[model samples]
Target: MESQHSSTTTARAARAPLVFVLAAAVCAAALGWTYWAFVQTTTGQFADESAWQEAGVAAPDTQLPFLRFLDTLPTISVVIAAAAILFVAVRRHRYGAAAIAVAVIVASNLTTQLLKNVVFDRPDRGVATLDFNSLPSGHTTLAASAAAAVFIIMTPRWRPFAAAVGGAYSVLAGVATYINLWHRPADVVAALLVVGIWTLIGGLIIMRTGNRWNDWQGFGTGWASSRGWLGLCWALGPGSLVLSAVLYFSVQAIGPAPVPGTATLPLFFWWGLAWIVGVGFTLSAAAGWLFADQARRTSARAVVP
Candidate 1:
C-alpha cells in the first residue's frame, strides 16, 4: 500500500506541472486572440469603441462610485495584498509561498505594462480612437493580480470562498474601468488572462513547496470551503456568459443597427460587464478546482502510511 501510494504521489507530482503549464498556455492563447480580434479587426474595433461611447450613458449619480473606486484602486489593492502576504509569512510561516505570491503579483503587473507600453501597438484600423495601445489594462492588471496574490496564499480549505470574493472584486474593478472609459472590454479581459497565467505558475510552485499545509478533505469541510461557494461560482460564471450572449443577440435581432457617436442603448456596456463577470468567475472557479484537486490527492496519499 505504501509503495502504491508513493507511486501515485510521484505520478501526480509529475502531472501537476503539466497541468499548470497547459492552463497558462490557454490563457496566453486567449490573450492573443483577444488582441487579434479586438485590436486588429475593423468590426472588433467598432464594437469596442461603441462600448466605450456608451459608457457615458451611465447616470451621473452612479458614475461617482465607479470613479472613486478607480481613483483608490491602487491603494486598496496594495494594502490588501500586503496584509495577505504578511499574514502568510508571519502567521503561517510559509515564507517561500508568500514570496512566490508576491512575485506573481509583481510579475503580472510588470508583464502587463511591458505588453501595453513596449510590446503592443494599436494600429489605426480607422477606428477613430486613440492611437496608443491599451490592450492589457494596467488598472485591471493591478486589481486582478492583487486579488490573485491573496487567493494564492490562502489555505486550500479557505481558497474556494477567497476565489469567489476575489473574483467578484476583480470583476467590479474591471467593470469600473469600463464604465469610466479607462479601458475597453478586451483590455480588461486581457489583464484577467495575464493575471491568470501568473497565478497558475505561482500556485503550482506554492503547492509543491507547501504541500503539508495544502492538504484538504475536499469541499464542505467548513464554511469557507463549502461546496456551495464553488457552486455559486460555477453558476455565476456560466450564467453571466449566457446572459451576455442573450442580451447581445436579442438586441441585434430586434434593435436598430448601431450608429456611431450615438448611444442607442447601453447594450455594449452591459455586454462588456457580463463578459467581465463571466471571465472573472470562471477563472476563480477553475483555480479553486485545481487547488482543491491537488490538495485532496495530497491528503489521500498521506493517509496510506
Candidate 2:
C-alpha cells in the first residue's frame, strides 16, 4: 500500500511541473506581448501600419461579402460553440471536463474584458495610432477561448486532431479580425495568451478528474496516435518565427520613412499575423503533448500491480 501511494505521489510530482511551465509560459507571453505593443515604438508602428495595410488588401469588392459575414459573426456564435463543446464533454460522462471547459471560457473572456476596460490604459506612447485601449481583443478572446475549451474536453487519442482543427479555427478568426481592421496583431497575441493560461488550468483539472477516459494509447500507425498534426505544428511554428524575424530585419534594413498610414504597412501586418498564428499553434501542440503524457502516466499506473 505504501509503495502504491509512493508511486502515485511520484506521478503527481512529475505532472505538476508541466502545469506550472504552461502557466508560466502564459505569463511570459503576456508580458512580452505587452512590451512589444506598448514599449517598442518601431515594432508597434510596424504592426499598426501592417494592420491597416492588410485591411486595404482585403478591401477589394470581391472579398467584401465574405469579410462582412465574418465580421458580423455574433456573440451567439461563441455561445453556440461553447455549448456544443460542453455537450460533447457531458455526453462522454466527463462532468469535470465539462466544468473545466466552461471555466476556461469564462475566465479567459473575463480577463480580456478586465484588461481592455479597466486594467490597462493606452498611454501616449508616441506611436502612430489612435490613443485607445485595444490590448487583448475581445473577439480574439472569444474565438480562442472556445477553441481552448474544445481542446480540453477531447480524449487524448483525438486531441492531436482537435488541437490542429481548433488552432486553425482560432488563427482564422484572429486573422479575420485583422482583415476587417478590428484589432492589431498584438491584441490577438495577448488574447491567445489569456486563453492559454486558462486552458492550462482546465487541462490540469481534466487530468485529475478523467484520467481513465483520456488514456493515451501508444503512438501507433493511425493519424491520431501518429501525431502528424503535432509534428506539422512543431515544424511550422519555428519556421514561421524564422520567417517573421527575417522579414523584420529586411524591413528594418530598408528603414522606410515613418510615414503614418503608408501602403507599406501591409507587409508588416501580414508578418505579424503569421507570427501570432505560429505562437498559437506552438502552444496548442505543447498543451496536447502535455495532456497525452499525463494520460500515459495514468494508464501505466493503472496497469501496474
Candidate 3:
C-alpha cells in the first residue's frame, strides 16, 4: 500500500508541470484568438460593436451603482491583494509564495497594458467603432489578477470558496466594464485569459515551493472547502455558456442586421454578459481543481516514508 501510494504521488507530480504548461499555452492561444477575431475581422468587429451599442439600453438606475463600483474597484483590488499577500508572507511565513503572487498580479497587468497600447493595433475594419486598441482591458486585468492573487495565497481547504467568490467579483467587474461601455466583450475575455496564464505559472511555483502548507484532506473538509462551492462554480460555468448560446442564436434569428448606433434589443448585451460569467467561473473551477490536485499529491508524498 505504501509503495502504491508513493508511485501514485510520483506520477501525479511528474504530470503537474505538463498540465500547467498546457493550460498556460491554452490561455495564451485564447488571448491571441480573441484579439484576432474581435479586432482584426469584420464580422468580429460587427459583433463587438453591436454589444457595445446595446449597453446604451441598460436601465438608467443601474448605471450609478456600476459607476460607483468601478470607482472603488482599483483601490479595493489593491488593498485586498496587498493584505492577502502580507498575511501570507508575514503570518504564514511563505515569503516566496507571496512574492510570486505579487509578481503575477503586476506582470499580468503590465502585460495587458502593453498588449493594448503597444503590441496590438486596431485597423479600419470598416466597422464604425473607435479606432483605438483595447484588446485586454486594464480594469478587468486588475480585478482578475487581484482575485487570483488572493486565491493563490489561500490554503487548499479554503480554495474552493475563494475561487467562487473571487470569480464572481471578477465577472462583475468585467460585466460592469461592458455595460458601462468602457470595454467590449472581447477585451474583457482577453484580460481574463491573460490573468489566467500568469496565475497558472504563479500557482505552479507556489505549489512547488510552498508544499508544506499546500496539503489538504480533500473537499468537504470544511464549509469553505465544501463540495457545494465547487458545485456552484461547475453549474454556473456551463449554465452561462448555454445561456449565452441561446441568447445569441435567438437574437440572430429574430433581430435585423446589426447596424452601429442603432437601437436594438439588449440580447447582445446579455449574451456578452453570459460569456463573461462563463469564462470567469470556468477559469475559477479549473484553477481550484489544479491546486487541489497538486495539494493532494503533496500530501501523499509527505506520507511516503
Best by lDDT: 3
For model 2, residues 244-293, the per-residue Cα lDDT tens digits are 76766666677644653465445565567677778778877777777777
| Candidate 1 wrong stretches, greater than 4 Å | 1-15, 249-258, 261-263
lDDT winner between 2 and 3, please give it: 3
The lDDT for every candidate, in the order shown, is 0.85, 0.71, 0.86
Query: In candidate 1, residue 253 scores what lDDT?
Result: 71
Clashing pairs in 2: 50-265, 50-269
Q: How does residue 122 of candidate 2 score in lDDT? A: 68
Order of candidate numbers by lDDT, starting with the best: 3, 1, 2
TM-score of each: 0.92, 0.86, 0.93
Q: Write out the backbone clash pairs for model 1.
A: none
Give each model's clash number: 0, 2, 0
TM-score of 2: 0.86
Cα lDDT of candidate 3 equals: 0.86
